[model samples]
Target: MSEETFQRYSAYYDLLYRDKDYETEADSVARALRAANPNTHSVLEFGSGTGRHGRLLAEHGFDVFGIERSQTMVTTARSFTDDSAVGRESGIFDCVQGDIQTTTLNRPFHAVLALFHVVSYQTTDADVDRTFANAARHLSADGIFFFDVWHGPAVLHERPAVREKRVEDATTLLTRLAEPRLDVDRHTVTVRYSITAQSKIDNQITEFQEEHCMRYFFPEEITSFARKTGFNVERSEEFLTAQPPSDRTWGVAYLLRKRT
Candidate 1:
């Protein structure tokens, strides 16, 4: 994985995910937060790429602080925040580039968020452990942690397949092909993405390759890590819905609270 993944795609990120409904996701996250602690107004988001979800949360009245590892992503997120009414104030939507696994801001928030498989992006045991520790450190006394990741049972049942996506606009045309290589022994999948972008007017083309290594997780694995990281698992359910996870569930969201 060249660290340049987000750097390469930050500009067209919103266009790439034009169909994504961040408002619904943020609402779901808010529901979970309210269920755990009704008065969550501040949030710290891990791996907050492009700050899409963070902005939505901020619009919904949460003071959002996002941590991203990519400088380009941070810049893009900051630009978006600067342009939005909900984020015109610096305190409403602030983003920083830092290692999510071990960053300590000397502060705690009403909640901690690892949306969009930020947890699965930590493919190593050490990475996962440190990320959970970071979340624990950033959470208030009664704060809750919310995260979603690829479900191990679903991954095992329906193995990953090669996929391609294309999004085009008046300015440019973008294509992405994802080829997955699964390591069952390590319980990880490395997806090699070939991205091609072409300018509409000049007919100029640019191509780049990036490998994203992600790990799928089981409920037990989450619980075990939670125990070691001073967190308590409150709920594990299929993401984007309240249904309990099953073998067919592709993604699972876990809600956790700091161990008191």
Candidate 2:
């Protein structure tokens, strides 16, 4: 992954996704974890972003640690924690800046999570393999690994299209345009993002561009990764809804249990 990925984007990340239902998603994750192992207590999250999910998971009564690739995101998460009363009181959530493929916390957790299509961000085989291995390393025996990814069937059937979103805060108006190019053979979609931000106070405008490549996965391929990493495939379902994945399902969640 590029070092510059999400560097500038992290500043506006929360604003772009402010409407997302983090609570519901976290609830689903908690249910999945408990169903896999009722004793689950500690959680290590990869691609933790600004720690929204981590905070919710912590509130669910689990000790949550997060690893994010962007230093800006890590700082933002920590700042939020320091400012929030609940965060200071509970103190069950913390995060650091690190890559999922290379960073080793040297401690095991009862569960590991890579939500919000974080695993799909690994666009290459080696990257995916290393990420899975890292997850395995951070998990206790029979620990659960749960993640969501773009489903191959859905990606292929529906196809990606250009889209735009506009959002604003008191200080700034932000517009983002996304154009996608699908590589059928590679099973990847490269999304080019163009963002324009205008200051509400001074009307000053700034623009930036970034490209992200995401991989969609098949069930068999995910099972293959689990098998190679000493895990047993527990289940797969549509994210949040827990419905069986089909061509209509865009995001699918998978549960894997690390073998003893």
Candidate 3:
């Protein structure tokens, strides 16, 4: 709901997600949304960081509106579609700045999505419920809502306590250190990131720290919550396929339809 950490990552978000197959993921979700209804035309994308998925949706001929909490991310997202000279024009991309838990739009959408583990950012049940309620308020009757979250079994089994990686480009060297803390009873994991970037200009190492807390709900718990929030639970799958989640699965995607 806040902006400082997201703002700091805005400059490097694309670089970090460059390796991720966002286009493939968008295609998969779009196919699922379309199969749910032939008339699906407009989509609302929450936590649409840098408009990566939004652009893909536009390319698929769907009207896409993105909501993000960070002003810096919204600015970068706007540039993706607004800069005609840059030749990255997807006129269907529109971005707004607001938190998913409390934002409202003028009209309802045919479909809604929150990809890239955005749902995990909600560390409390109240936050999750508020987000689902807000999304339901903006969804047309029979519209589908799709989202993904970190898999509880995977986190509990793997217990990835620490990680370190570095990315170097022509102008910058970015180093990242991650420390994970697990709370078994809460089914929550808090990751602390210590990031250091050395600018090519003077090779100065600038340091920044960010803490992200993610709640890992069981598959049944999530589906039950969706049903309680007035959604007809459609399907929950491991990753991109319709399969039971396992201890090694990193995340699971859920598809829910607004009760008609």
Candidate 4:
């Protein structure tokens, strides 16, 4: 959560996630939330980077408020929304700058969401538990919480040790490299990023680095944690499916309801 990291990558995030289809993912998450608690109207989105998912939820008729850790990301998100006609027309989006573990809002929401592996960014059990507790604090009675994270089994199996890629547009070029570190006892994976970008005309290259650590929990462990946090531990499934999670699943998505 460094300003330098976000400042370096703000312009590239949208391009990197262009194929992610957050709108569809948000719809899927919203559907699950609605099924668990049909009366949801207000939503608080944690780690809402660049507001991609938040915008989608707002357009779908939820009053969406976003919390982001990076001011640069929030600034870029604000500009992106400002430039969009749909965003201007909807007017249901609000962005706040804060960390997921410590941020406070004035009012509770009917649903809370942290999508696109944001939950994985918590590298330790304490961090993860604190984030869940914070989410619970922001939930109204009978509110539901939804989030997705990288499945442990998938990470251990894939064991992505190295990757390199480049992206270019008319005006700029971006180069990215990823190195993975595994902490088996903790079931956590940390990816160190090295990014270099250059302007097409000036050819001025800037380099930056960031580390993203994601803790992978067993499905039962997640359920137990949710229960301890006063959630009803509704169910969890492989991403985008109703099927039970398996070793082959790359991610797990959860639906937890506030104990009424």
**Candidate with best TM-score:** 2
CA deviation > 4 Å runs, candidate 3: 1-3, 83-91
What are the runs in model 1 whose C-alpha is more than 4 Å off? 85-91
| Alpha carbon lDDT of each predicted model | 0.86, 0.91, 0.83, 0.81
Model 1 / residue 127 / CA error / Å: 0.2
lDDT of 4 by residue, 24-120 (tens): 7878877886788778889999988988888777777777888988887788778766533265445376788888899999899999999888888
Model 1 global lDDT (CA atoms, 0 to 1) = 0.86
TM-score per prediction, in order, is 0.95, 0.97, 0.93, 0.91
For lDDT, the strongest prediction is 2
lDDT of 3 by residue, 1-260 (tens): 33465667667777655678987888898898889888998999999989988888887778889899888889888987754223343438788998999998989999989998898888788899988988899999898899999988888877767989788778888888989988888878888888888999898888888877778878877877797788977887886776788888888898889997
**Candidate 2 lDDT over residue span 24-108, tens digit each:** 9988898899989999999999999999998888878888899999999999898877533275435377899989999999899
Arranged by TM-score with the best first, the candidates are: 2, 1, 3, 4
lDDT of 1 by residue, 91-127 (tens): 3677899989877898889899999888998988898
> On a 0 to 100 scale, what is the lDDT of residue 131 in model 4?
88
Clashing pairs counted in every model? 0, 0, 0, 0
Q: Report the backbone clash tally of model 4.
A: 0
Q: Which pairs of residues collide in model 3?
A: none
